[model samples]
Target chain A: MKVIKITAVWCSACLIMNKRWKEIEKDYDVETISYDLDFDEDEVKEYEVGEKLPVFIFLDGDKEIGRLIGEKSLEEIKKYIEELN
Target chain B: MKKLLKYILVFLFFFCFLVNVNAKEKVTLYFFHGDGCPHCAAETTELIKDLEKRDDIKVVKYEVWHNQENSAFLDKVMAVYKTKTGIPYNVIGDTAIVGYNEANKFEIERALEYYKEHNDKYRDVVKLIKEGKEVKINDHYSKQDDKTDKDTTITIPFIGEFNVKNISVGSAAVLIGLVDGFNPCAMWVLLFLITALIGLKNRKRMILLGSIFLLTSGLVYFLIMFSWLNIIISVSTSILFRTLIGLFAIGAGIYNLYAYIKNRNQDDGCDVVDEKKRKTIISRIKKFTREKSLIIAILGIMALAISVNIVELLCSAGLPLVFSELLAINNITGMKAVVYDLIYVIFFMLDDFIVFFIAVKTMDVIGFSTKINKYSHLIGGIIMLLLGILLIFAPGIIMFNF
Candidate 1:
C-alpha cells in the first residue's frame, strides 16, 4: 500500500505533521508528494481550499478515502493510518 | 568744562541703568513635577541645569504636592481643564507643561517663547496681583466664569505637556508588529500551510482542515502567550522588561534565520509510492475511523507550531511585561493588574491577528504553495538576521546621545 502525504515548506504545523508522517512512513510504505502552494495554483483550486492550509487528503485508487484538515497530532494521524489499513 | 562733565555723567548713568534693566529679565519659569515620576525628575534636573547657566532665565521650581499656596491655583485650573493628571504639572508663565523629560522640554520652550512675546502683558498681570489690584477679564486672560469661546473653555489637564518617550514606544511597537508580520519566520509557517492544503485531492476537505489547523494553531499560540504574560508581569517592571523584550525579539529573528539556513540542505529522500499504492494505503486508514478525530493530530501539530514560533511568542509576551514593568517602575500606580494586562494582551494580539489573517488569505488566493517553498528559507534568513541586528544595536542607538 502507498500513502501520499502532501505538504508545503513554510507551514510550521505542516512541517511538524510532515515529520510525524515521515516517522509513520518508516514502518509503512507511504509516498509523500510535497507541493509548494506558491507554484501550484491549479492543484490548490482543484482542492477548493478557501483560506486554510496544511490540509490532508487520503485517496484510494482515485476514490476519496479520508481527509484531515488543520494541524493534527502524530497519534491522530497514526489512528487514521490504522483505519485505512 | 562743568557742563561737559555733567552731560557725560548723565549719559553714563542712563547707560548703566539701561544695562541693569536688560540684565534682570525676571522671567520666572515655574516647573511643576512629581517626586515619584522618573521622567519628571529627569526633566526638572535638565531644566534647572540649563536655566542655571543662562543669566536671562530665572527658574522657580514647584512641587505640586508640597506647594500649599499653589494648590488652590492648581485645583481651580484643573477643575476646568480636561486632561490625564491634574497634579505634577508645569506652568512656565502661561504655558502648562505636563508629563516629563522631552515633553516638559517642549512645554518649557513654548512657555519661554510666550513669555518673551507677551512679557509686558504678563508683567502687568503680575503687578496687579502683587499690588492686590482687581484685574479685569480680557481676551488673552479670562476669568473662570467666562465661557464664551467653547473651544478654549474646555479645561486641559496637562496641556502643553509632551511625553515623547512614551509616545515613541507606542509608535515603535506598531512598527515592530508590521515588521514581525512580514518577517521570514512567520511567512514560512504561512507558506507551509498553503502548499500542504493545495496538494489534497479532496479540495473541500483540504480547505476545511487547513483553515481549522491555522486558526487553532494561532489561537493556541496567542492564548498561551497571553497567559504567560500575566505570569511575567507579576514579577518585573514593564519598561525595563519591554526593552529586554525588544532585544529578545531581535535575537529570535536572528536565530530563526540561522536555523532555516542550517536545515536548508537536509533531505530524507523518502521514495514516493505510486498513485495506486498511495490510494490503497489511504483507504486502509479511512476504514479505521468514519468520524475525523483530529484532537490528537491538532495537539501534535500545535506542538510543532509552538516549536517554530517559540521565539516569536516569547518576544510577544516579553513586550507587554516590559512595558508594564517600566510604567510600574516609573511609579505609575492606580492601574489595576487585570486591566493593565488585558490592554497589553489585546494590543499585542491585535498586531498578531492581523498578520495571521493576511497570511492565510494570501495563501488561499494564490492557489499554490510553490512561492512559499521558494522563499521560505530566504524570508526566514532575512527576518532573523534583521531582527538580531536591530535588537543588539538598538540600545546603543538609544544610549548614544547620552
Candidate 2:
C-alpha cells in the first residue's frame, strides 16, 4: 500500500504530521510521499486536494481508495491499513 | 489749480477708507422667526429700528411659521447647530441666540461685532444662503435639484461625484466586512486555539493565550489591509485586476458550495482542515503546554497565531480581497480608508471575541466550539456562494457604484 500526505510548512498541524510521518515510515512497510500545498500545486491539483492540509490518501497501486483528514492515531491508521490489505 | 487738486486727493483718500470699512465691517444676522409670534414681531421691530441707526448690521429674515421653504431652511440650520427647538432663532457668524429678551440685546450686538471681526468662518455659509443654496452641515443629507427632480450630487472626498443610487460606498464596506467576518478559515483557527487551550484546564492560561492569539490576528489583518490598500490605490483603475477579483470570487464560491454539499449531513462540517492537520495542531499545542514556563508557552502561541494566517488565507482570502478591492474602486482613502479598515477588522474579530470570552469565562469552550463547528460549513458556504455570484455577475450590488 502507498500513502500520499498533503501538507504545508506554515501549518502547525502539518508540522505535527511531518514528525509523525517519520515515525510512520519506520513502523509501517508502506511507501509514503509528502507534498507541500504551496510548492506542489501540480500534484495537489492532480490529486483533487482542497485547501485543507495534512491529508493522507491511501492508494492501492495508483487506484485511489480511501482518505483520512485531520488527526488520527497511529494505531487507527495501522488498523485501516491492515483492513485494506 | 494745485490747491484744488490737493483738496480733491484728500477727499478721495477719505472716501476710499470709508468704503473699505463698510465692506469689511458689515455682518449678516440670519433671523428665523415665526410670523404670528408676538415676541418675534417685537424683536423684529426693535431689530429694524436698531439696524436703521447702524450701518454695520444686515438682517436676513426667514418666517418659519408662514413659509415652508423658510421652515425647512430653519430646520436644516437648527439640525446643523444642534440647537434647542424654538422659533425666534438667530444665527450671526459662529454665534447663535435662541430667544429674544432684554438681556439678549447685548449678545446680539456682541455677535454682530464678533462676526464682522472674524468673517472668514461664515463666508461660505453666508454666500450659500445668499445664492439660495442649502448650507451643507452634514454630507449625508440630500438636497433636491429642481432641474432633474433628483438629489443634488456633491463630490464626496473619497468616493468621487455622489451617485444617487441604492447604497453609498461607505455602507457597502460595512456590509462586506460583516460578511467577511464570518469567514470559515478564521473560524477554523479560532476553534483550534480554543479547543487546544481549554484542554489544559487552566482558565488563566486560556485567557492569556486567547488574548495573544486574537491580538496577533487583529494586528496581522490590519497590516494586510494596509498592503491591500496600497495596491488598490495604485492600480485600482485596471480592468484586469477587477476581472481577476470577479473570477476569484466565483471560484471560491463554487468551492465553498461544493464543501457544503459534500458535508451537508455530516457532523464534521467542512473539512477545510483535514484530520491529520487537526491531530498535528493538537500535538503542537500539547508541546506548547509542556513548555518549561507558561510565559514561553504564551509567546509561542503568539508566534503560532502569526503563522496561522498564511494557512487561513487559503480558505478566507476571498472575502477580504473583494472588500479591499471594492474600497479601492470606491476611492476611499487617507483617514477615511483607515476608519473603514478599522471597522472591517472590528467586525471580523467579533466572532472570535465572542468565542474567546465564552471560553475564558466559563472554561468550557471545547463543547461550545464543537456545537458551532457543526453548522460552520453550511452558513459560510451559503454566504460565500451568494457573495460570489454578486461579485461575478453584478459587483455594483455589493459596491453600489461598481
Candidate 3:
C-alpha cells in the first residue's frame, strides 16, 4: 500500500508524527508520498484534505482507500494499517 | 656612534607622534533623529550643523522618520546600547547619549574627551554597527554614562513638557489588547456563544444575556492579569526568574511564529480544545440559553464566560502574561497598574463588542475575517520575540516602547 502524507511546517502534531511515519514505513513495507500543505498545494488539493492537519491517506495504486486526521498513537496507527490490510 | 644615536631618537619621535595621532583620530558620531520631533529637529539644524565644523568629530546623519532601513538600523543600535527606545539618540566611541539638550551637548563633548584620554585607539561604534560586528559596552563608558535615555519628552499647549512614558505604556496596552482579542481560542467561544444567543428570538433577553456574558469575560480577564502582575512583582527582583520568564516569552514567540508559517494556507482554528471538551461546552451552552428562569440564565451565562476565559488563558499565546510582566518590571504598581490593565481588557473585548453590536443590530452573526487573525499572530510573534530578547539581555533599561 502507498500512503500520501499531508503536513505543514507549523503543525506540531505533524512534526511529532513524522518519525512514527518512518517507523511505520519500515514495519509495513509501504511506499510513502509526503506533501507540504503550502509548498505542495496543487498536489494536496487533489486529495481534498480537511480543516485539521497531518493527514494520512492510505491508497491502493492511484485509487484512495482510507485516511486519518490529527495525531494518532503508534498502536492506533499500526492498528489502522492492519485494518486496511 | 653619534650619527646612529641621532637616527634612533628621530625614529622614537615619529612613533610617539603616530600613536598620539591614532588616539586623537577624527571620531564619527552617529546621530539618529526623527524629523517632526522638535528637540531632534533643533539638534539637527542647530547643534549638529555647528558640530559639523569641528575637525575632531565627524557627524553622520540618519533621518529615521522617513527611512525604513535607517529606522531598523536605529533599533539595532539601541538594542546594542541595551537602552530605552527613543530618538535623538547619539552614539560615539563607547558613549551613547539618548535625549538631546544643552547639557547633553556638553556631555557629548566630555564623552569624546574621555574616550580620547582613556585609550590609545578610539572605538568607532558607528563603523562597528555598519560592519554588523558585536560592540561591547565598556565598563568605564557605563560608569561615566549619565546620558542614558531620558525617553522622548513631549510638549503640550497647556501641559507644557512631560515624559512620554504614560503614552507609550498606554499604546502598548492597546496594541497588545487588540492582538490578544484576535486569539482563535476565545473567538471560537464567542462564536459559539453568539450561536446559542441567537436561539433566543427575544431581542431584550439576547442583549441582556450577551452583555452580561461579555462583562463576565472582561472581569475574569482583568483578575487574571492582576494576579500575574502581583506574582511577577514578587519575583521581579530575582535574576533567574526574570531570565526564565524571558526564555518562556521567547519560546512562546517561536511557537507563534511557527504557527503563523504553518497556517499560511490553512484557516484560523483552535487546535487546543479537543472534540470531547468541545461537545461538553456545546451542551452547557445549549442548557444555558434554554434556562427557564431569568436569574438562572444569568448565572449560566456567567459560568460559561468563566469557563471560556479559563480555556482562552490556556491557549492565549502569552499576550496577557507578557503585558503583566511589562507592568511588573516597569514598577507600575497600585492604582496606576490597575488602570493600565483595565485599558487592556477594554480593548481586548473590542472584537466581542463589535460582533455583538452588529449581531444585535442586524440580526446576523458574523466574525472577523480569518485573515485578520493570521496577520495578528504574525505581528504578535515578532513583538514577543523582540521584547523577550530585550528583557533577557537588557534587564535594567527602562523599556518605553519597542
TM-score of chain A of each: 0.78, 0.85, 0.96
Highest TM-score against the true fold, candidate: 3
**DockQ, all candidates in order:** 0.11, 0.08, 0.02
What DockQ would you assign to candidate 1? 0.11
Q: Considering chain A alone, what is the TM-score of candidate 3?
A: 0.96
Each candidate structure's TM-score, on Cα atoms with residue i matched to residue i, is 0.33, 0.45, 0.53
Task: Assess each prediction's global lDDT (C-alpha) against the native.
Answer: 0.46, 0.63, 0.75
Residue-by-residue lDDT tens digits, candidate 2, A1-85? 7989886543444545566667778887879887866457688878876655568899989988888765445676677777777
Question: What tens-digit string does per-residue lDDT give for candidate 3 at B324-389?
Answer: 878865657678789999999999999889988987897657645445667887988987877787
Q: Per-residue alpha-carbon lDDT of model 2 for B140-234, expressed as tens digits?
A: 11211122212334678888875453246556556556656665565656766676677778777778777988998888887788688767655
Top candidate, metric DockQ: 1
Q: Taking candidate 3, what TM-score does its chain B reach relative to the real chain B? A: 0.60
List the candidate 1 regions with Cα displacement exceeding 4 Å. A1-85, B1-38, B46-171, B182-196, B199-207, B224-402
Question: Which segments of candidate 2 are over 4 A away from where they belong?
Answer: A1-85, B1-175, B186-189, B199-201, B265-272, B366-402
Selected candidate, larger lDDT, 1 vs 3: 3
Per-candidate total of colliding backbone pairs: 55, 8, 0
